[model samples]
Target: MVQPANKRLVTEAAIETRLTTERLVTEAAIETRLTTDAASRWGAAWASGSTSRLREFFAANTGPRVAITGAPIVGTVTVASQADASALVGKEVQGGVYINTPDLELRDFRIKGDGRYALIDFGPFASRTYIHHIEFDGQQSKDTNAGLGVSSGTGPSDLRVEWNNFHDLNDAAHTRPGSSYKYNFVHDPLVWNTAAWGAYNPAIHPHTDGFQWLRGSGEVVSRNFIEVPYKSVSATPNTNSCLIIKTDVAAIDNVTITENYLNGGTRTVMVNDGGFGLPTNISFDKNRFGPDFNDGIWQYSNASSMVFGSNTWAQTKQVVPTTNGSLGYRSAQPALDPDPLGFGCVMTNLGYGAAATWGAANDARYVRALSGGLINGIEFHVTVSSGNVSVGVYRGRGRGLTHMPYDLVATSGTVACPAAGAARIAIPETWVEPGDYLAMSCDNVTMQLLLFSGTAAPLFRPLGAATAASHPLPASAPSPASPGFRMPILVGTFV
Candidate 1:
């Protein structure tokens, strides 16, 4: 019997053992530094009457780096004042303040909309804004307006929406559960017999999409909690999904839907890609669809370039619409890999399915040799189609305790990455001794190697250059039985 060429073999026999004295760095550190800049805070007190003072405050202060907040404002505050909406870029309205603005951050506020109008109506154009940590209260029943609506137009792009809660919009026309649900009624009558909402006679928005992205790019909807009560809609269509991304004129691109908590009476995500063009580079990563999430993830369409990774389901089987999109669903658990997403790539003790990216583009960490051996091949998994990838091996040149420049060890020839699946690259042979800190870096190009995923606080190395910084391995290599940070590097030659 002969072992396969690419298979890994570990053995213990009568042989000399040479050990390196470098200590293992246990903390999970990436080379990229997280931003520590905080938004400037301004305070406001909610007063009785029109609270026009709040509106006046916004008209005065205008800057790119300022955040305003009101502790608690009473009454159903109506914001007709378009205070400095044009010049107020990167400004945030926070803490129970009700506002309507374009190109600004609407955060930490309580927005109330009457049955006749929208609570937050982002005009025909807006861009580069943040909407999060706010609560939208609508008329429990007979609410004809949307909780958050964006008219069909331009500039609803480059937005980061997260950690917001939407409930009590009462998105159904008439929800009466009992025999009172007259089937003979001429109009569509929604019936919900339960006591989910204290006000049960529901009249929902015409298009009850929670966050409607009519035309946008670089939009990320993540970690949001949306709860839509039972039997909410009667007649109007497209009122189901918590988030709807559609365009009759432009294509929605670079939208990432990840880590959301959607619980309601309707579908999860609705992508109508047929209107003008299909949504491209859409990614669904680790979202939770609750029992109330019905219909499916996508309503219907022929969308392409989608990556659906490891999502968790609660109390219901996952249902997705049939579409012509090149949908990539990672559902199977890989053998010997603890990742539920079944990505066969792992490099950490942290369970698999948690994927990381490395290279000059996403610069995270390094792959160092644990023993004295010949470097042979590099194996990795990719998600994109075909592209040129340059793989480089570097040895750290230490100068005192500070992180140092890299010395080239071996570089793989230009390799072709597949549209999907495993990629193996044979590198020019090289030797490595124990305690040598080596790094495997990819060129800043299309496609990235899937790294072991985890939530550990990352360690950072100071590159000291304008574009410097990288992950360093331990000064010493551990026993094969006690490997630390099992990165996706899996090929080494026995010396």
Candidate 2:
């Protein structure tokens, strides 16, 4: 049994050492800077074969505490680092607000495919591991491929994926748990039903993502952006929500989801249950969720609330179907019955301020004429789905208002009613704007929410000679009493 290829190299070359940035330029500074511009590129590098000299150079000069490198990688070229990582991620093209296409491949390391997904070594030249700022593309597929994978073997620790973007790859959205995936872009990397995340993994397992069975925690997936395109008539529109922490009987705690944006995903946020029960102290706050291809915030499709909310959903907007010019429809003839009668849209132009009673499928839209006073309250009514259902109101400049609101009307519901089985509720329209609002569905059943304002300040009072009809005063008519004053409260109250 001669020494294995990976083992023999580590001991003889003293590849387990450490190094620093400035040292690479020194005669005895420790690291051997190769094609890498930054000496730290090979700081703790290691690899498997003769091409692995890049890894050996970094490992032989370890001890630079600022950072540590993983096994040196080479695919199209032997370890393309420095400005190479940027190109692989498909950035610097047309990403506004700093969005990018994640297109990458890690072709050096290997994973045993025993179905258990066994771990392979990062070689010996690198004793420690660190995932640098890079991008990975999943080919818009929903498989178990990973940017960085973790198998059953290996007692590794302290890993960090920071300041990087993982988007536009349709692989599973799950990553190694217990690893800190923060301040990095984890967008649209893809989702292939990958199971469970070691979200608390600092390196291999950091012990803070609510998975406690491993007695590990403290890794987080936070403060980045996520986006998925609706498969606009293609085949499969690339999309999936944030992260998944399957119920692996692992106790996960102190998981934090904050200050990020998730746009156009038809799935749930952070999943807290997997039959193994939700990890404790799990929270989601200050995150922006917008118009998904489907629902906004989906906690569970087969279960109930698994995670609590102290979550902050601010200024984020979603476009929805409202009584606005584009979505509204006016009734050409009010002679037709618009109750719970039709199945599809029959009437049109049911614009704002119109009564909230129409058949099940009446096309109606309404608008409000305000005089700059608080909107007071709203009274809404509607029927429910005969099957399980959920309903809520949406108001926004560009988002689903129900994504975050002052009050949550109802959660789980069944049957077909809006007040009993139905919900007749009062929503505070305390402050109204030149904005728009609409009613939408939360469940996949017959959905409806009819609404009207509680009481609004009058725009102008009638002169007794006019009502909504009668001897209605003309707009340019002279007053019966004062000079220069034609519109006066002849009968209605001012306050």
Whole-model Cα lDDT of every candidate shown, in order: 0.38, 0.30
Worst 10 residues of 2 by lDDT: 485-494
Backbone clash pairs in model 2 (N, Cα, C under 3 Å; residues 3+ apart or in different chains), count: 83
Minimal lDDT window, size 10, model 1: 176-185
* Candidate whose TM-score is highest: 1
The model with the greatest lDDT is 1
Pairing residues by index, what is the TM-score of model 1? 0.37
Q: Estimate each model's TM-score.
A: 0.37, 0.36
Error of 1 at 213 (Å): 2.7
